[model samples]
Target chain A: MSRRTTLLTALGWLALAAALLGLAPALLSDFRLGLLAKYCCYAIAAVGIGLAWGRGGMLVLGQGLYFGLGGYAMAMHLKLTDAGPGQVPDFMVLYAGGEMPVWWEPFRSPVVTLLAILLLPVLVATVLGAAIFKRRVKGAYFAILSQALTAAFAILLIGQVKTTGGFNGLNNFQSFFGYSLYDPVNKRMLYFLAAGVLLASVALMAQLHRSRFGELLVATRDAEERVRFLGHDPANVKLVAYVLAAVLASVGGALFVPVVGIISPEDVGVGASIALVAGVALGGRASLFGPALGALLVGYAETSLSESFPGSWSYFQGGLFVVVVLLLPGGLAQALSALASVRHRVGGPPGGRRRRERPASDRTRPGPTTPQEVTA
Target chain B: MSVPGRDYLEVRGIRVEFDGFVAVDGVDLTLLQGQVHFLIGPNGAGKTTLVDALTGLVRATGLASYDNQNLLDRPSHAIVRLGIGRTFQTATVFEELTVLQNLDIAGGVHRRARSLLRRRRGVPERVHETLATIGLTEQADRPAGVLSHGQKQWLEIGMLLVQDARVMLLDEPVAGMSAEERRETGELLHRIGQERTIVVIEHDMDFVRDFADVVTVMSAGRVLAHGTVEEIRADPEVQRVYLGHTVEGVA
Candidate 1:
């Protein structure tokens, strides 16, 4: 497809999604609308995973650290506001007396809370990415390092009951900006905000993917040593992409707390992080729209299946991931490409012969020794 | 013989050892401005090790400088930024990216932050010019991984061209090319050598004879002979170590 046509098609899809979201209040019940809103948050998280894991090849299995940071930030402000001046939130009252934790004091202001949510993840990711990428660590080693961080973050949160509200997490938020969140209109407005943000994030990702920075990201992914030889620091390139992905995940988490009316340790843990990546992989990591579609699909399946099958929903989710992994290693996007290639092969004229093939020795040689190859 | 006016790169007593194994020991070499120099040796004779040291891929013990700046302490990326570029023995073109995208990224090394942030202009044109020079303009939009091996090698060279580096270090540039492709690559290197210093590591003596202005023969981690190809071919030590019994035919 031509670039112009492809962009126009994407714009049309965005417009259709926005129109549907604008009309959702009239069509669906409040509960279903809320579910869709939650899915938008998941879609936002999936987009971040796509950039970090799919394009940059970082395999960031600990996106939950950023997610929880954002969620907890937003949740703390909501709890403090709901408790009125000076009073402690109910969760804090039961968990650790009727006193607000010192760490939670800064989040008393909504502006400070929101800023913290966004800035904290970017700061953490920058430090983490710089440390890891500068060392030239990559592949499975990088994946494990990220996953370990998520586990550590979750454990720390669970241990700090006085400050973080611990396992129960700060919930029962009554109002947002003097508006009752329980009202159907305000709830729908929040859903619209999430959908808008999801669409805008996708558009931003598309722009980045087309730019020169995006090419460098992919080049680093494919061959960091070669990219270094070309006079571009691969660590800096990967760091930029990594930090962007973390910020996106944090935004998703912040929006998620307000839309779902709840935030908990269970939601931002190792399990949730893995699920986020599975959805992106199932959708097609390299494609622009795949992660959003895949996240929404997974979200819908979780909600609908639990309503019908209850205890078996997790099993179904596990099975679906297995099917995608076994049958479509490239995710759903590859199916389309496979079909196109098959059609071309069948439709080509008869008597078209394969070109002459070169000997094995004529192919390029192996890459230079990497850190891993050297140690091994 | 040393050139009267300029030296694009100079190496003095450079030695590279890995895990106590001397790969290239005390190897001194130099390439004058706009000259094509060749490094040739038998298996494990440290030709690639020398290229690695020059490009900053491997650390060396002694003085290695480019344009009078010490290269031993600089990172690989910094070396490239100092107007030195290299191609791997294996083609290092971004496999999933298009040929044009690869060249555009190559040009990005020298781009300012402001220019990099905006829609990249001038890169497409530079990519086109480089592709055309390498005779791969027709395959500009195709994924580089899908190109023929010789075409991929040329595309990599095109990348080095767009990078606008003053010195090019190629590791076996004609390793996998057909005879015609090798001749075309030889002619292309000759043209490039007119404007930039080129150091090529190769096993093909025929290509070396046709392309090299100066040939340095290495064996057992040291320079065995350094002279014109015919002059080196006639050297008794080079004949004994590198050419062996086959020197009579080439001589």
Candidate 2:
């Protein structure tokens, strides 16, 4: 890495730390802070989506499936614990007429719930990835398959009304590990925890992007046949990346439950998956910080818009997406770069010669190609 | 080091059919350890198809074995793990990756549980050595996409070297090369043949005549002749099928 890149990376992390831990709670209201906490969870999922869909060329539209699995797992444990040992949870009686489901028994223990949150999504992704990648089902076929999985997962969860809490979904949790979530201090603590986890996940992703495995993953995505001929199994490499992305999404979902205090089939359905993808696209999918920023901004916009114009928020969101897509194909990051260039042109050395040289060098720098073209 | 009674590659009446159109038909060939075997044929003569079948990129109907192991049922990656490396007719390198990184990926890593937890080690030196051998050491840091056509071919061969497979299958390794580059590549293949079995598919008759220990000529999805260049040159069927139809001064 160059000295300039090193310094920029360090400064970026420092800024992120300050924004999450130092600035968020001080500037926002309690409700807004809670919303930001929810955004952090979304940001986590977006990061995984960016890696799999953007860099690895997987087009994983079903990240919400993993997210839901993790959230429901944690929610089950929380509901069970809140209800105490012998008695059934209140939602069972209210929603399902007092019949406790057999499948929900495993999640009574915190350890089992946590493990399930991490492992279940990975296992599912492994099987799905192996099945699809081995057959060289890629491009539109892969995208459709993954989207179908998401739709199936959501429908399955919705159909399992008794066990999964159904369309209304799992909610009305009173406490999390005896911390009385109604307490503002506990809410703030959850916010901090979300921020901390988001930071760690970003750091981990950054490390992965720089590693040899990352290089191979991108290469496999770009030219599957070439990588295969080079003696590396493209399927296996894609599987690793897919599983990692799934696990990360699951973790994000697990944290999202406590932070947002509810989750539903609707939240993990096909529409939700598309929303996640849109955020990544709007933020610059290949960029390190793009997904996180995009997710947070989208989340914030959703909440504020719903409050300001409850019936028209979706239309506004749709319009915003269109404008962003039209104006910034490379996402907000590229827009920022363009803005910086304009500023430089306005303020820098007077003669147009130096300005002319800038764009020429920029053109020579090789803009990021699509994941498929990257290795071809 | 040729092992006693151990042929590097053994194909017995292998046939590959794509949707009932035979691409490689009943071809029998063997590559002994530490020898350069050349496959020379016209376009669509099943030279690439044969290489594809050997590397498990495409399935074959008949018995195909490598180093005494059954290769007909194995997956392409499993075939690679069983010590077979291959390159495509068109130059295929990781365009985004530097030349060194491309070699490193080709050099298989020890799988410790899942690949996510595994670390790639000791590949840099191997990559460097392969780069030096292929005369690409000065351009090791350059992206593979930007290399000259001849350089890209060398880089790919370097990738095959780093893979450390007992058998290397190269399809048209000197395609699109300048005359000088083709000569250099012929010499490089000669050097690599000492360490591993090399099966090269080429249309260039001069390159095959200069480098091949034995030439397997294919036409119409089958092996037409298998012998020394002079022996193949004297075959009437080969002359009628190939040399007889060729334009003058092409070779």
Could you give me the TM-score of model 1 versus the true structure? 0.91
- Clash count for each candidate, listed in order shown: 0, 0
lDDT of 2 at B29: 85
TM for every model, in the order presented, reads 0.91, 0.91
Interface RMSD of 2: 3.2
Clashing pairs in 1: none
Cα lDDT tens digits for candidate 2, A91-124: 7887778889788888888889989999999888
Looking at model 2, the pairs that clash are none
Docking class of 2: acceptable
**The 10-residue segment with the lowest total lDDT in model 2 chain A:** A367-376
Task: Show where candidate 2 strays beyond 4 Å.
Answer: A1-7, A320-329, A336-376, B1-7, B110-123, B248-250
